[model samples]
Target: MPKTEKSSMSWLLRVIPWNTTVVLFALAVTAVLLLGVHYYMEGLISIGTLFLIYQYTQMLNDPIEMLGDQVQEFQKAKSGMLRSRELLSMRSEIEEGKEEQLPQGPLGLEFSQVHFSYNPDKPVLQDINFTIKPGERLGIIGRTGSGKSSLSRVLLRLYNLDRGTIRVGGTDITELSLQALYRRVGMVTQDVQLFDGTLRDNLTLFNSDVSDHMIKETTDRLGLSQWIDSQPQGLDTYLAAGGASLSAGEAQLFALTRVFLTEPSLVILDEPSSRLDAATEGMLQSAIDQLMKQSTGVIIAHRLATLEKVDRIMVLGDGKVLEFGAREELASNPASHYARLLITGREEELA
Candidate 1:
């Protein structure tokens, strides 16, 4: 159903019962008053008795209204419970891998003949194949819905593939535990999450093992030292939940800082600067450069300019690899997709 139609239905569901209860109560009160007057007029009851009955009828009003309110609350609680139960009962489609550890150091990534789809008939990734050597950076460019983000999702094991295998450091990803896999691969997206706590807490994720000096060093490396100095309490400064006090550029920097601390073997940048202005993006790009130097990087970017620093480029179309080669080689070839995007300045549109 459309969101607007669903909202209207929900509004009606809430109001109809309340209105019906009110109208029924009014009718019952009117009926009682009419019957009381008839009895009094026919000499079946005294004026004092009629007055007493009317008083009793008024006394029932509070309890009746309370009952209606209770019913409404009950319905709300029941609906919430049902939804919660549905979520709780659901299981992850990706099975837990064997409790094995991933190899240490920079890890190479490989995807071979991979196929995946949310629905069986409609595929999102089809026969996708690629490889990145340890310590090499690869830039991925594709139009929206061309599976740029899906590549990251599958690498993270957020979803299981319908066919084929993904390997990290010559070992199938499915052979490593989810914890081990996550510890080796880190991803930074445009949506950075912040908690309601001190800046230090958000940076360290409340981990006491991370010293203040290390935090300061990482921030300085990422060009966040000036921003930190501006805060009244430095690291102790408290931020509102969900990054309410920080600008979009600041939030992206925060996410990058987290990835730096972890020092993962592989880093995925899924258009982390897509929402920022040019000046802010330039600052972020420098930080990203620092990050790429320390790990194998996969940059999924809509803007071709962001891919300039990457060693190689991969172009995706309809979930299939259209072009894959060294960045310089593709840029020099006039017929290459990357070259065409660069010449026409339509990388964003094509991506």
Candidate 2:
């Protein structure tokens, strides 16, 4: 027999012996006998005796049922404990450091000889190197699985680098505290998660430092104030689970509002307009343009049009940089991959 079949047979055999079917059959037989004795042969056994037998059988079955439930709960807890142990045993990726601060204004970023892999044997990013000047806007584009997202993850220090260093504001990112790193770098994604609270709570993220004036200012900038005003209670309006009440574009705008309030030195936007309709995408584009004006920005976009306003573009292919330079320079080169992408994008639009 095949190993899988043998394992299945073994599991069946183990389970068959401990099943409740046999006990239930025995109980049924016992109840029938007691019923017959009490009703037909009334002198030999009384109804009270029959009732006592039923009660005793029920008492015997109750603990078994309870035990089955307890066993299931125990299994669940055991699985949780194993996962917790695994997490606790793993060490943090961020190195110990006292540097808990970054530059006060827009910060530049540099990646030097960086390489990383989810599995050490299969590298996801290969010898990546790049630099973004403070307040510069760079757009990243690549085919799927091109390591575009991995670059952002490495900059955010979500995973430990297998080789090389990343510098933010002239200080090695790994040498900075995780909190400091995150506080200076912000990210916005297409799928925005809304908490179960009023609109104000979702916008401010329960941060007391965020003032109503700031919220109003940012919302106005993002063109979200009109939507807020349309609400019956404005900021006090309650959003159901995952903000089911708001449209997708509104939720995304709310996420941008959160990022704006933070005033981070750098921002990463991962296809923020990819899933939106034409009108919503236009709104997202405007908001993104405003965001880029305030901070150094890296935009990972599939659509070439979104890169029009960026200062530079980085094209990746198979986890490697195919081209990196000024958008205008890359666009003028018909032989370049970015030029091909733009031509293809334009062709698709016309088609």
Candidate 3:
């Protein structure tokens, strides 16, 4: 079920004896000994003959079974090996994960006429333009494939833009150290990736220096304290692999806690509460409120209620900024592409 144990089994299967070979060899030797004794009494055979036959049988079967074991191991190892390799080689988010040594960022992001495509001759994002001031709170919303997540990637330097310049703290991202750039940024995707470790370890990521005070403060404010309080080990509670051990809402809330602890200058959060129940969504809202307070954030939100508090909403379509301004202004106008779309999505929610 887990990678380590599965791989270990593969190695064992590859090395363990074929067993059939051992059983057959024992039977052959026993038969030879019996026949040899019979021949000795009848004066028809020598001990040398029996020894040679048994030794030759062993020499031929041992190598064959050893090869069979190796093949068995190979077969068992195949699927898991492929999965790990594919994950390692798959296209990375926006840009590759390189190390950066810089201090603070979100610095300032501007997209001046950028275009992108997942495949050649077919583009997903067309000309786009927007400037997010350092510490500016912005929300991006669009229908699926409208390029919301892609927009986050561009800002986070997951992938570089084809056209336009993306500057961080007054320097073009191309010129900044990737690791330094990322160190100052944190993100919580709709997909939360938690490790197989203690709750504290998952939260602090082994940082060790993140004070328990901060962890407690975040969970308390977000109503996570209730669950944590119930745990026998408190922060030391173990988080099962893939977070299967956690409820969907708790996992999402935990992800927020992790981002809050990181204190990145720029934080990007995809809507983890998009599918949550109202009560759970409310908890998520409180967590998000604390996260966004006095900090820079880029939110890719679907629910209009979720975007209501943002400083501004950037409406994206076909990979470009179709509308940008105060949420109130966008909502008041019934004719704008964003307004119409937002209205449509809301109606669907109500329906």
Candidate 4:
């Protein structure tokens, strides 16, 4: 049976004993009342008085039954509270050190002999080693579970590596404060999260210091100025939860705009165009191109069209690198995994 069904059954079994106890206790109380009536007032009590006594006893029993139910609900609530407490009490995986410092300016990244896993026995990234030049735009491609997303997580210091080191701007990431690392790296994922606020609030994430001119300039550069102007409220327009007023593509574009305002040295796009239609993908592509021009980009994409302008491509399989080189060079070799992917894409396009 499913685990949920089994758990429900177990809970029912626990409550059964308590319910049975309450039922037996109520019956015992009723029997005692009858015995008292028989001994003390066998001939004196009227039929009406006996009926009233029985009715009062039943009224008392009803509250006892309700108490048992309340106890069961309390038990469930306590269990949930304890689980939440356990999660809240755990320490963060990323640690801050007193002596570690971060470097400034555009940052290049290097992953050397990196290995990590959510589980100790099952590694997610194995012996990964690669370097990205300052301001280089890299395209990463692989099948599902090939560790494409994991790379971005590691760069942001979201998870510590079980082995090896990651360097940003020539300084080891582990040696830098978690705050410093995050300030330098940004990521845009497939799922776009928008808060319930105005467009400008979402873009600046409620930071009061970002000037209107800066926000407008970045939006214009990303080709979103035209759309923003068409909106009735423009930047002041209110957004519902998850940006309900906007389409998925519009939400993602808004998310991109938010990240652009930060001006991070490294940007990771984890399949930013996957959910978008062709027209939206084109818009996303154009926005991404502009964003990448000023920062080092690490794009994790499935579509070859998205990788056309990338400086290099890294293809992974089963947590290992299959090929890593210039996009043109990798696509030229028929035996290369990237070349095979391109051929497959072309065939699918024709069909």
lDDT values for all models: 0.85, 0.79, 0.74, 0.81
Candidate 1 regions with alpha-carbon error over 4 angstroms: 1-35, 42-45, 194-201, 206-211, 231-248, 272-278, 303-305, 331-335, 339-350
RMSD of each: 4.0, 5.2, 6.9, 4.5
The sequence of per-residue lDDT tens digits that candidate 2 reaches over residues 1-351 is: 776885566556545544654467577758766675757475766777766766776666666766655665665566567668978999976674569988889999898998889897888888888999999999887777778788888888888899999999999987898889888898876567788888888888888788889889987887768868888899999987666787777777777778888888899987743455777668777888887787999988856657888998988777788789998899999987778877777522211
Estimate candidate 3's alpha-carbon lDDT, on a 0 to 1 scale.
Answer: 0.74
Q: Estimate each model's TM-score.
A: 0.82, 0.76, 0.72, 0.79
Better of 3 and 4 by TM-score: 4
Strongest candidate by TM-score = 1
| Candidate 1 structure, TM-score to reference | 0.82
**Compared with the true structure, what per-residue lDDT tens digits does model 1 show for residues 182-210?**
88889987577889999889888889999
Indicate whether candidate 2 or candidate 3 has the larger lDDT. Answer: 2
Candidate with top lDDT is 1
Candidate 3 minimal-lDDT segment of 10 residues: 96-105
lDDT (Cα, tens digit) per residue for candidate 4, span 1-351: 776985687588658866886878778777967765895476777767777777777777777777777777776786677668978999986786443455565678899999989899899999999999999989888777888888888878788899999998888888887777778788887677888988888889899899899988998999988778777899998888766788877777887898899998888887643356777778788998988888889998766777898989988877898789998898899998778777777422211
**In what order do the candidates fall by lDDT, top score first?**
1, 4, 2, 3
The CA root-mean-square deviation of candidate 4, after full C-alpha superposition on the true structure, stands at 4.5
Rank the models by TM-score, top first: 1, 4, 2, 3
